[model samples]
Target chain A: MESLVNPYVSVDCVLLGFDGEQLNALVVRQSGNNGEDVAGIYKLPGSLINLDENLDEAAQRVLKQFTGLSQVNMLQFKAFGGPDRLKNPEDSVWLVRFYNLNHHIDRIVTIGYTTLLRIDRKMRKLEGGYEAQWMPISELPRLAFDHSAIVDEALKAVRAKATLDVTLLFDLLPNKFTAAQLRNVMEVVLGITLDVKNFHKKLAQMPYVVPLEEKEDGVNHRAARYYKFKKLKNKHI
Target chain B: MESLVNPYVSVDCVLLGFDGEQLNALVVRQSGNNGEDVAGIYKLPGSLINLDENLDEAAQRVLKQFTGLSQVNMLQFKAFGGPDRLKNPEDSVWLVRFYNLNHHIDRIVTIGYTTLLRIDRKMRKLEGGYEAQWMPISELPRLAFDHSAIVDEALKAVRAKATLDVTLLFDLLPNKFTAAQLRNVMEVVLGITLDVKNFHKKLAQMPYVVPLEEKEDGVNHRAARYYKFKKLKNKHI
Candidate 1:
């Protein structure tokens, strides 16, 4: 054997967007790549790291390409660099196509990152690529590589994190929103019906929920005052 | 390039043991022909999988190697096959160590699985070249490749699971252990002081804990009756 070929590591971003009634996962179209029979089938926003950049930075760059938003929070959840998770040649899993791997083994690697974003059409103008669409979380399409698996893992993480952290809920709610709309979003993400009284009782305990000057308008019932959560950097128990 | 070499997926086990107070990570001294200096230091217990082996089965096989105890509960927390998380002579972090890796990278592709195990010295003793030892979880020595980081990630996972699942706690406790002993182990693993009363209350709610007639003889304070956990398959929730 002459020399072992370096394995490839790519970054995949599983961006989740939550609306008031349902949850959606962000997927992108793969086009103009190494092999491209499949054009616009949805997949997690992903790309190979450029020669000059680091891994986390590479993921951020990929997301920015899709959303035109940079410096958003992200993390590496799992690395899927399987030699054969990509057995089908025509599939996106075929990213494992490494040259000179025959001379020696090439173990392909890709890090999976999950991000929760409050994205609106106002976020960015689409160019060259198709616009990002929010698909129902449960109804995900046949994704490329182990992306379905990645999506599954990201959902588990989101559910676990949402249970303990209200900070993510804050991210989803807008500047001024009705409590009913807020509860609807929370219920959708949590996948359970929460008692209004119990939820209000729990929310009352948190001092961070500052009562805003704003109030709901044109409601059939009595108008409710809108409250905003004061950002707590080091939120401790 | 010829047909791309199929990528292989393997699971590495980072079995952790919490003997009363401090935590220790299980590591094996590998005796193979990859890197010579790696023989003495710690790397996770791992193995390459059979072509037909599913991810979980491969991980279980790797975990049981040290213990000889089959059906040892295990978890695949994260996949860590970074094509170049390995040092390669091609292009890289291993630019200095590149030549060394050029000679190496093809040996194996390892995914890490972290498990909390009941420590038994007999299980740790390997017949051949591999030396299995329980080293302090905090002060683990330099491990082979990124095995050290894999172990750390496993620790985080083991801790997280311990909090959410009672089954993980059973792995830490003795067959018949006092309530205080169980709570102590939980605190050590979690690095938190859980409310003792609430912890026991939750334990009482769990169906698995079978109360034993045994009690600690030497204890000066209130002696708590020992309870052993009934194992369940994937019912950690």
Candidate 2:
């Protein structure tokens, strides 16, 4: 059968989910390598896109196939097409074996996409004989292909977006979050340490961050007031 | 001879330049179609990448070949890979004739890139038998293929970056510009009008927008004070 996928182009998704603490990325174990050392290696959930699908559609299909999540907003951050992207022999071996390619493939240009998800909210199950897991960004294992660099670029893109759009933070936080939780989201996304007082002062200036009457119920420390991001009628700060 | 360029991947550059007033984009007339109407249609300066070249290298090569300008910073904004990007029949004809390909070409995934330039500073000469011209953004002609959409996306990316980095505005402005010129850059790039007093008040808060001792001369009316962007050791607001 003729291959339905494009041989020279692929999409790699950086599925970053916040676990209410640190940001984590979803990675899948590579399969069908005949028990080689590269068989169990982790890689970003991605593959060569089908000829009939749009790039975004291909990314969405990859995201769903690996994590069983649909309708998630994914941003195309960058395209990795270095001449030596497949310099690592292991990458070429795994690709040829896994894809069952009869012809030699020298290079594949992969587009990098990213999305933020709440870890507790989404139900994730590994599919297609592949094992998947969410590993914290700091402790990520060495990824296959140029995926480590892809992850770093994805993080930079997410941080750049966070600086402009405040609502991106709401995607990672719970429905009602304390000021500390908000600060945590900001710090983790932006990769910076913020003083509590200064952060609160900055947060107070944003009209979209509405304070709720409810407070934390069960906690060891004092119950902190909760805040919810209010949907503004106009452009957000 | 075997084709050196990758048929499946290409690069399109959106070279925007500020002419001390409105922002303009550098576009080139498509050639080599026996003087057909499609041959004269304008498109963003772009072409497919060589098998051995990186994406950035391909974009840089195209930029230099079209405009005779080199070493300008370009940012990869997005990838356009819709299955029907070549639904326009003219596009397929142009591609086949331009590349002299024997096989059927169904799709080409083109990475969109953008860069800001000062029109008065760079000596732009049309190269490679193509007539290149800078058309004001407000008066861009109907472009071939999906280039109109690509230009729009590039403008959006530049505006998004302008909000985060002040240095981006300086790229379009003269070294020493009046306050009105600065405001004009902000308005044109961000696509918004700013009140003179309010905008000046906001500019005052930015420490990097240093005021120069010299004022504008040879003006019909009272000259406005000149200001230059001071490179900060740290981040600029």
Question: What TM-score does candidate 1 reach?
Answer: 0.77
| Cα interface RMSD of each candidate | 8.0, 8.7
Candidate number achieving the greatest DockQ relative to the actual structure: 2
User: Residue A55 deviation, candidate 2, in Å?
Assistant: 0.5
Residue-level lDDT of model 2, residues B1-237, one tens digit each, is 121122378899998988889899988887654544465689998988786788899888998887777877799999998888889887897877777666567888999999988888443444235667888999998898899999999999888888778676777878899888888889889988889988888889888898889998998999889998887653311
DockQ of each: 0.18, 0.35
Docking class of 2: acceptable
lDDT at position B216, candidate 1: 76
- Candidate 2 vs. true structure, TM-score: 0.88
Clashes of each: 8, 0
lDDT of 2 by residue, A31-64 (tens): 6546444655799999787767888998999988
